[model samples]
Target: MALGGGTFTTMNKILPGTYINFVSAPRASAALSDRGIAAMPAEFDWGPEGAVFAVESGEFEKRSLELFGYPYTHEKLKGLRDLFRNIRKGYFYRLNTGGEPAKNDFATALHPGTRGNSLRIVIEAAEASTEETPVYDVSTWMDDTRIDLQTVKTAAQLHDNAFVRFQAEATLAATAGANLTGGTDGTAGDAAYQTFLDQIEPYTFHALGCLSDKPAVKALFTAFTKRMRDESGVKFQTVLHRYGQADYEGVISVENGLTGAADDTSAVWWTTGAQAGCAVNKSLTNRVYDGEFEIDTQYTQAQLEEGIQSGGFLLHRVGDETRVLTDINTFVSATEERSSDFGSNQTIRVLDQIGNDIAALFNTKYNGQVPNDAAGRVSLWNDIVRHHQQLQTLRAIQTFEPENVTVEAGDTKKAVVVTDRVTPVNAMEQLYMVCVVA
Candidate 1:
């Protein structure tokens, strides 16, 4: 009989062999995780059907044309460009659905949008020492220039290209150009956003930007955010335009969206990214608006104060520049004791960071790896203490004590219980003091 070969689940066959288990000591890292990812919906010229995708700031321009059939600087991409002006990277979902792809006599555009209408297919004779093979040079052109080219001798050699796919299976015939037509942009509805929310539920992002001013759409987002945070324990914030009554810790309602030039509330595009880009230990209060669009800052002093009182995200002129006055969430409640602390977005960030970090620590390090014994529980408590200690070291929390953390056996042998307390730190936002008379 081999030594240490028997299993130890239900009964131990000690007579035949012996079994033992070893676990590594829990280690908590002090490095804070990066947290600038954001999510939003938009009308794109092209993309995958009904899904969310990521686009980094460095690749947005190139990827936009490659995937969506339009360059980042195109007029149709202004809103998306504005979003990326301050955001370095993020996940984007297209809300508009069900559109027809533009088709030409030679091929069809990859996605449905007006941008595809500019595409044209050109066929020319292949350049070779001998033209006896009768090979053709196929070129995919957008406007006057060709984007993709291929050489094929037979119709069967003609494969699908990135810009357009081949349609004809007959004999190869040279043509001057065939312009694509009938490309149209799909319409956006409330259901489209709902689908986007559902598709993005599993994704982790710091903030969500809602560009619509529809009350019903805003309400749907508010409800979805509350449910995800409260029920599922997913932590993230959402920014919407002119949704002051949202009154939730996870929701930010922008009082003004567009700059004074237009009535559109496009400010949500930038605010969402900026809010997400803020570090966990920092705050966006008094942060300046450095994007292209001039945000609407036409509010009077009284109006600005009222907007803050109502938990609205307000931008005001600080001398010649416009800056965020106070970063706040819509959580105005006089009765509920815990509701008051949730007003500041910084406070929410701290709490959310703590929650997300601890959950990650537990799930990754402690879950199923450690046994359900008293020693294992104590080890978990120790890990928790170390995690909190690191948080304190980073100044994200204060007054953390190892003795405050406790872990014990749960109602069942397979479960464990944990209890702890922490005092999260918040940024300074206001100054009200009396100066002695000189």
Candidate 2:
């Protein structure tokens, strides 16, 4: 954490974790009828410090304390979990022209997702012949006889000292942009739908500090915790994760076919009719009562066993070969152990992480198997979110259909409806927005 003092220190005690807003303090004004809102148009921002209520009278703040389940503790973790701490939360950006990390600048000039620097020097010698760039491993000026700029790292990387470097004062130019007036996304596929789609973020939201209206840290902390408990409890990301297993064309005995067809009389040719080498794969003996049911991806054998007893059958929703194999193995064990009717492939990876839990409950659907690239992942997840909106995520926020949703007057409340899919990782797939009481 960057202390107010000039020196930066490492905070060891802080183990990253997910959190939400929780309220304890009462409202000074009669703005919120239930949640202690100030009843007027206001900015209620939450962070590590506490609750920040921005009303006409003035901005108010509050503090929060959470009950964590971590078994071990130490001094290093001290003040680590402090609310609203800045971090490199899966995000990177180039600082402003004069900005430097070592120099200590918070607001950055470069936007996120800028590809790494790797450009050849096309220098044209001009002015004095003594011109040169910073000496790294080597220093060779761009040869044109007309100009002299030693090829150096990209300007974004060259924090300081450069007469002619990555960003040439005359050559390099940054695209000018104004504040985004509307939503972050310019095009509209399914803003409502995309939000419900789980977007498993890093344990870095606290670190990758946001430029929100919380004003101060204390207000942010109190509000964040209050919302965590008060918002909603049916935690999970809902998704109709589609699957197309390898085309199967194998035949078993008539008895196994369930038809008890005459072909079962002998060891007939088990032909997997496939024109293409699709590798028709199956669970060897996989079947789930020929239907569907929800199962958390993070559950263990005991949990699966308990869930199966409820009758419908349980399985994990998988998108890769590993999941398929694990689910099959677990199912086989359960079936053989109890002669049960449980099926394989029932668990789901809500966050696209190792488990199934929705941490960011703003999106409407749960999308997984996205590209490793940041931009691609965001796009693919958006599509999944649209799918969730179509499937009863939030009736108030539809894609093509405009269904007006209403909240009580003077209610400056923001509702983040999460996906109720199998096992949610967190509010990964969710939609977020402020509700102006109308």
Candidate 3:
């Protein structure tokens, strides 16, 4: 038998034949995470309740009917269309799911919502049916269009589709059509919004949208944002309508409203998507609004300047196109710890990326796995320096010095402290030119 031929901590083995230890060569553990993810609580007529669902940009148009209980072109999906225009993926929570489902003799709606009232079931005898085997052709319709068709001999054989669930006990009968009724949409109260916030806490999204114009509801979202950012270390900014009074870096206050729309806070949808989809090196300043809504951009120059000074994210008309005035958040009052640079959304994005990426690196590569020694600290410092270098290469940040990063032991043996400095770059929103001619 081989004697004591493994890794050693104290080298006090009695009869060791051969001791060997293998380890992977040290490599940089820095990698940038993808963006373009957003979250929102929407008052839709149909969807899953009490949970967050993911919607991808590429699949929204194709699976809209099944996912949202409406076709892609339906007016109900206008807000979602605007949001998906820029974002790659969205985490959506239905706020009006505490309602009653529509039902008929044959089937019941899968989800509780007013949209389910449009469902109709049609049953007819199949051509191949006989007196012995009475096969029925069952068709599910949403309004005039047939959505699903199945051939079954009895109601028990009829399977549930995306729209509704069949009543297995009901007898299958040949009927022209039976319309579903009694569906209702519940009111989205503060409790429903609070539930949405709690459910969405575990999700990692770059931006969040609050479409409520009520001050109390906006305050709720603002408080949630601050808590997630400061305490939980989850960095994300929330878009709100006319909430500049929040005066927090994590809240983006939209000053411009939309015309010809029932929802005055609809602009928040597009802004949230844009913020989440924007690259780390880019800014939304002067970016044209290509959404479906008609923005009210009739603010004068002085009013626009004042709005910017008050930490409002505004949209203005530029040569017959609606454009973002400036990409800023509601952070007018800044302290020494967080200077005026924190107000810029681009700056916030850089800081957030650094925080998230470094946290991920530590949790995955170094935390609890590496030895708490000088070599481990040096490894972490090297990874951090490489991350900063990559950011500088992407032009997201500038003037990053490797010497500025340091990792040291914390108060406890298991704890560590890291200090890093970075300068985030912003887009050129203003230009000054002076010329003299003789």
Candidate 4:
């Protein structure tokens, strides 16, 4: 070989060839992540079993029948409709799974639920068929509506559709209609709810709704939320009905419920979506309740004040419409580590945005790729500064100083430590003014 032509940390190379070290100039690697995602565990009459499924707001109306076995206007989707009123996307887990699927001689229902009982398969001879080789027209119907139509010489040529799967091995025969039967809905119990929580752990949602009236179930959800937020570093709030005792920043206690609903926990659906969809700089205070349910907003002024004092997220009547009285979480007991500011949902949103975004930036750009050196630390600091500056511009936070952020190598050579300080901003919820004499 002629000489060494690679990077060097010292001038110990004895070769005469040029030893160069090329490095790109540091640039900001921080970008804020989007919100408007929520998670909910629901008991449905029909849906996918034992799995978490995503439903986007844009596709909810069009794909409702295929996904939930009901049209968008059906009464079964009222809770989902309320949820989608605010959130852009939802990770939904059906608590009632493991039920029996409806089946007939021709085909089987795609999912397990009572909705499959409405399905029927009709077979008739196609007009193009002859006596020697007859082609059959197979049509799958849900009630009176025809969902799928196929023409095949044998059952083996048939393909499955959204509603059901054809029995490829079964012989084809012309029948008026073969109705599917024996479909049953699974029971939603504590174990099923626990399974839903387990399945939803890996998902990233801004809010989670616990639509259970049982105190034990609410406690379970609250504990999960706390563990995820404190230990796992996943930041999200869980909305629970009448769960103000949680007293944690990661839980929002819905004080008011629906007026005429069997499940009084219905309000949690709307609150969860609203919380998830609220922008980092925005507040849900005074946001009109545009959901489907008629919320119980009959609270006295003293009660409303008490609700806020007890860290309850309440809704009250404002003129002709119901509106959010205060955007706060169940964070009543304040410690030196966490001040009263943590009670405000707006403040929590800002803090969560910073934590999640900075963690993402470090994990994606710097974790194992950047060396643990002074220059590398400075680069991280620059990115953090830029991120905070963006937050300041958005009015989510204020009083951010670049000098306050410090990144340094840890005791281990491979470890790096970061110290970040930020002041989150809250909305102006109270007005106190004095009239002066003219």
Tens-digit lDDT string for candidate 2 (302-378): 75455433221223334421121122211223434343222222121111211111233223222233223445434
What tens-digit string does per-residue lDDT give for candidate 4 at 1-438? Answer: 776678889999987888889899856679889999999998887788888999999889898988888888988888899899999999998898669999999899998888999999999999999999999999999877899999999999999999998898999999999999989997888998889889999889999999899999999999999899999999999999998999999999998877865348889889999999999999999999998888998889999999999999999998899999989999999999888998999999998998899888989998889888899888888999999999999999888889879888899999888898888888898899999999
Instruction: Decide which is better by lDDT, 1 or 3.
Output: 3
Give RMSD to native, each candidate: 3.5, 27.2, 2.6, 3.0
User: Residue 178, candidate 3: how far off, in angstroms?
Assistant: 1.3
Query: Model 4: C-alpha RMSD to truth?
Result: 3.0
lDDT scores of the candidates, listed in order: 0.80, 0.22, 0.91, 0.90
Error of 3 at 42 (Å): 1.3
Give residue 36's error in model 3 in angstroms.
Answer: 0.9
Over the stretch 1-438, how does candidate 3's per-residue lDDT look in tens digits?
766677776778798577777889866669888889999998988888778999998889899998998889988888898899889999999887569899999999998889999999999999989999899999999988799999989999999999999999999889999999989987887788899999999999999999988999999999999999999999999999999999999999988887765348889989999999998899999999998888888789999999999999998999989999999999999899889998999999999999989988998998789998999898888899999999999999998899889899999999889988889999998889998888
Give the range of the ten consecutive residues with the poorest summed lDDT in model 4: 256-265
Give the best candidate by lDDT: 3
Compare the candidates by TM-score and give the number of the best one: 3
**Candidate 3 Cα outliers beyond 4 Å, as residue runs:** 1-27, 260-263
Clashes of 4: 0
Residue-level lDDT of model 1, residues 1-438, one tens digit each, is 456563466664656566655667645542356777889987776766688888888888777777666766777676677677766778877777788889976788887777789898888888851466787888888776578888887756777877777776656678888789998878888899999999999998889988887899999999999999999898999999888798889999877756554557778887898888887677888888887676778889999888989889988889989898998989887465685778988878887877787788778767888799988887777767887787788787888889888898989988888888878777787789999998
Judge candidate 4 at residue 286 and give its lDDT.
92
With a 3 Å backbone cut-off (N, CA, C), the pairs that clash in candidate 1 are: none
